[model samples]
Target chain A: MKKLMITLLAALVAVVTVSAEVPAGVKGKKLRMALVKEWGTGTHMIMHINGAKSEAAKYGIDLSVIDANHNLAKMAEGIENAVINKMDAILISHGKADALTGAVKKALQAGIPVIVFDNDFAVDEKTANGKLVSMDQYDLMMGLLSQMALVQALDGKGNVIYNRVANVPPTDKRHRIWEGAILPTYTGIKVVNTIDLGTSNPMPKAQTALETLLTTSNNIDAVYAVWDEYAKGFYNAIVASGKKIPLFSVDISDQDLAMMQTHPEVWKASAAVNPSLVGRVQIRLALKALAGERIPRYYSMTPILVKSADLPKERVSMKDLAKLYPAWGSSDAFVEPWMSTLKK
Target chain B: MRQEERRLTTKKLDIFGFFYKYGTILVTIGALLYFSLTLDNFLNFNNVTNIFRSVSIVALIGLAITISLTIDGFDLSVGATAGFAAVIAAKFMVIWGYGVVPAVIAPLLVGVVIGLFNAFLIIKIGIQDMLATLSMMFLLTGISVTFQDGSAIYNFMPIPGGGIAEHTMSKAFLAIGQGKWLGIPIPVYVMLVVALLVHIFLNYTKYGRYLYMIGGNQEAAKLSGIKINRYKLIAYVMSGFLSALAGVVLAARLGSGEVDAGAPYLMDGVAAAFVGFSVLGTGKPNAFGTLLGALLMGILLNGLVMMSFPYYSQDIVKGIVLLLALGLTYYKMKHKG
Candidate 1:
């Protein structure tokens, strides 16, 4: 009876010890994670959250979320809070460089590993500061595709309105790439209106600015938005105004793809970033670190150019959309489905 | 003795009737109930803090419009003025490396200059308020674009050999945008302070009494020895100063001046200021009523976002709600009259 009791006690202790699996992705004994600004920009956040949740499962790790909501002050506070909470790792996506350094320093002081995704605040990608896991290479792809689209629509020469997202690093860098590649290549292309549509809520203001431009002159031959969201609004105003200007933009969301297929005036083409791949890679690297393995300072995610013509024929049917993107299954999702309701 | 008792009962009824005249209390209660039940994260500290942080700028801008609405004149240039002030603040901070106090105050002074210009155009040049302010909006936007080189001014990048003090100080400064005061956002407290002061200045003081009387009947107030044009000019200056102050807060929140950061405020200000009509009663714009208006809209936005509703659909919902609120208020007024 005593021997049997000892064995049973040992088994119970083993079960308790093995419950917290040093997850597949976490290299260290524990897991640490952080995300900044998760509201207003719902589409971006949802994609990120989906990736985070999936990776967290593969690696039995605890994830800490901080919604900066695009405020620099609060974002700093969030970073401080995460450090104080004794997180193992830190990740950030921020617009301003100065606002993020303090948080980065705090995390560093706490002896935690930090990885920056989406935007590099103070880290150098080529050096050994911290890995900048990003889709910036996609911007270069955007620049190339934008030029091709512009060329195809304008016949290599005409006035165009570059509805750009100014101040943002990737967007601004993409513009430089576009300018270096396109402006010198196509001399006949008269870049008439280089409107900096600003960063946040670029769409409505861009649409209004476009409408104003149209009223003043009919010389605008094409519209090029830096991102898919801005493209949606610009295309809407163009279609609604009964104008036949060819609209081109980068970044392919499912809605963007649907819009491209249906909008007669919009020739939508975007370089796609496989967020699933990014999530998998990020988790793997983080796990390696936890496991006391040396990893590269920076990792790059490759992007693919996705045209409307090259998309999957299996459209997310009304029935299956619920399973595929459950966030869109809500009744409220259909409220602003204008972007996807294009009847081609 | 029976008649005396009946008279006392009627007096009690009169007090209740007058007190319940404004239906803002009902709307507040409805907002509280709806947010509590609908938002999964509504009760959490994180979400509540987010709400206050986001609402501060709108509240300040709304108050500016509320002041103007009381005088039967609206400021369209307020939004552009905000953008211009933001750029100026960025310029002072980043380009000139000025001290924080000077960086903040310089932009506000420019606002005063623009406001004076606007008041001059309306009061002296005989331009209509709406048309004149609209032109000024266009002009100020042009100035901001020109100064910013058609791009946003990001002043927060680290300098060589500079310690982390630059970054820390800037973050500290930005905390003033929506920092907490006694567990409430600093902007909310600031709004309360400014609103109370303005309310007293407009309602309790003789100058305020004259200002409202002018709105009620301008010619009669002028005939009764009120300095009509002078008071109107002061109102414009006051609107300008508040708009400028709001701009500083926004700059801290946004952390930079993009080309058109303040575009939404133009329409939001109008919507919120006019919402005061349906707040306390039609044809009145009170400080308390403006706060209620901003709060109602803030709650609506928070609830909608929490429910995962798209941001664009908010316009349609707002329009519908505005129509309903105004319709109900008009119905009640008709019944009362």
Candidate 2:
């Protein structure tokens, strides 16, 4: 009877340990993750949420989300709720970070690990509480190199308008990369004008920004906007300007791809990310953080440059989008002991 | 009380009396309940506060339109005036190194100037109010875009020359956009105060009474020896000032100066003002009713968003709701006439 009791007690303890959702050395424990987004110009929000969800399923996690729809007050509320609920972890993306400083600080003090992507704030990315990441340096390099090639195509000499909101950190880094990696090599190209797209919707904002630029200046050799929507503005502006110029940018939307496919001469190329992959990467980071694994203070997404010639024939068909930019659609398995170590 | 008075009081609770008294409020409550039930998290305190905050800007703009419609006149350039004021205020903070006082005051002055321009074209120069204001609308939007060579004004960036002028949007200015008071967004407070003041002015003040009379029937107002043109001038100037005020608040809220920021608000303002007509079957534009209309829109938008409905589809729902409101009020008013 004593031996049977000992065996049964041991089994009960083992079962209890396996069922408990402890953060460290734990797998298959349900993790509650929350995402509060500031804005997503296109399918950016949809893909990002989907990517996080897909990855969460692998980690045995439940995800709840809120979108601010560009309201700072609404965005701030989300952070407050996440902190108040004492969530396992929170991820925030793509918004003015200054507004959420107080709420995010509260979350950090509450011992909730926060993972931020593209939302650099007053705090250093290297924190015990969280990590801040950007698009991969490799992706920045790809975007710069593509810009260089386009400049070279113009015989290393033309009026290049830095059309993106260059002051923004994400675009700022790419601008630095362009200056450091590409511009010094080809001194012939000059930045004639820089577009200041304030806070309008990217579509109309870009169009108006470029249209205004067309009035005083002419002889633009090429335009480089930070994203595909910014590039679309250039395409529309160039059409309105009654002038044709090659346009280069990063980000590939269905609209961007369609425009690039039809107006190849104007909408030249873009450095595109597999948004779904980006989402998965962010979730992987969150999961890793939850598991007490030390992650890099910062990480960037490595994107691929897809030229007009490289895209599929039908930009809007049933054809797989991955075929258009195969380089971006990488499925490199994440190697980690805590990850994929599911409980029996 | 007398028996007759008691009878009248009892009748006040009847269908027509109820509709006349509580129609808009009732519809709004219905919407609130419906959204709270159908959409997850829609009934939460944070979400409800958010809806109010989101509508605050549009509500103020709607208030301005309400005033314009009250005078039997319309201000087509209100949205353009708003956009122009936003860029101007942003430019002051970002480029001119001015304090918040100057930044705000400058837009108000511009609003006065714009009002004078419209008033001149319509009252002095004998242009139809609608046509004149419409012309000013295009001109204002064009000028707003054309200013600074079409690029938006920001703290630091490459200018026309090879040099970069560096500045930061003032912390005080940013606070106006991002600050909260009493657990409520500052914009909501501003909206309420402004709307209430307008309500008092239109309903209680002698100036307001004259303005409403002018809107009701201009010839009768003139026959009563009212300075019709002077009232029209005051009305337009007020409209211009209010439009500029909305612009200033928007700039403060967004933390950046944007071009055409007010462009989208024009439709929203018009919608809210028109929607007010059905509230309580007033069939006329009023501040309180306009705010309520904006509330309806805010609730609808919040509910749709929470349900993960597409942004584009929200417009379809808005159109449908607007059509119902218009059909109800316009049809009822026509029958009564």
Q: After superposition, how far is residue B323 of candidate 1 from its true place, in Å?
A: 2.2
Indicate the residue-level lDDT of A84 in model 2.
87
Candidate 2: C-alpha RMSD after superposition:
22.9
Query: What's the C-alpha lDDT at position A283 in model 2?
Result: 77
i-RMSD per candidate, Å? 18.8, 18.3
Q: Tens-digit lDDT track for model 1 on A1-344?
A: 67436534543443356433232223234555765542323333445556655665655666766766457788788877888888766666544767777777667656556655556555544333343333233567666766677787678989887755666666776787677878888888887666554556565445444544554456788888777667766765576456788877776554454456556446556554544444445555554444333555655555555555644444421222335344323222111111112111
Clashing pairs in 1: A25-A287, A26-A287, A27-A287, A27-A290, A27-A291, A28-A290, A28-A291, A37-A68
The count of backbone overlaps in candidate 2 is: 6
Off by over 4 Å in 1: A1-344, B1-22, B156-169, B328-337
* Candidate 2 accuracy as lDDT: 0.71
Q: On residues A87-130, what C-alpha lDDT tens digit does candidate 2 reach at each position?
A: 78888876676788887777777766677776666765433444
User: What TM-score does each of the candidates earn?
Assistant: 0.49, 0.52
DockQ of 1: 0.02
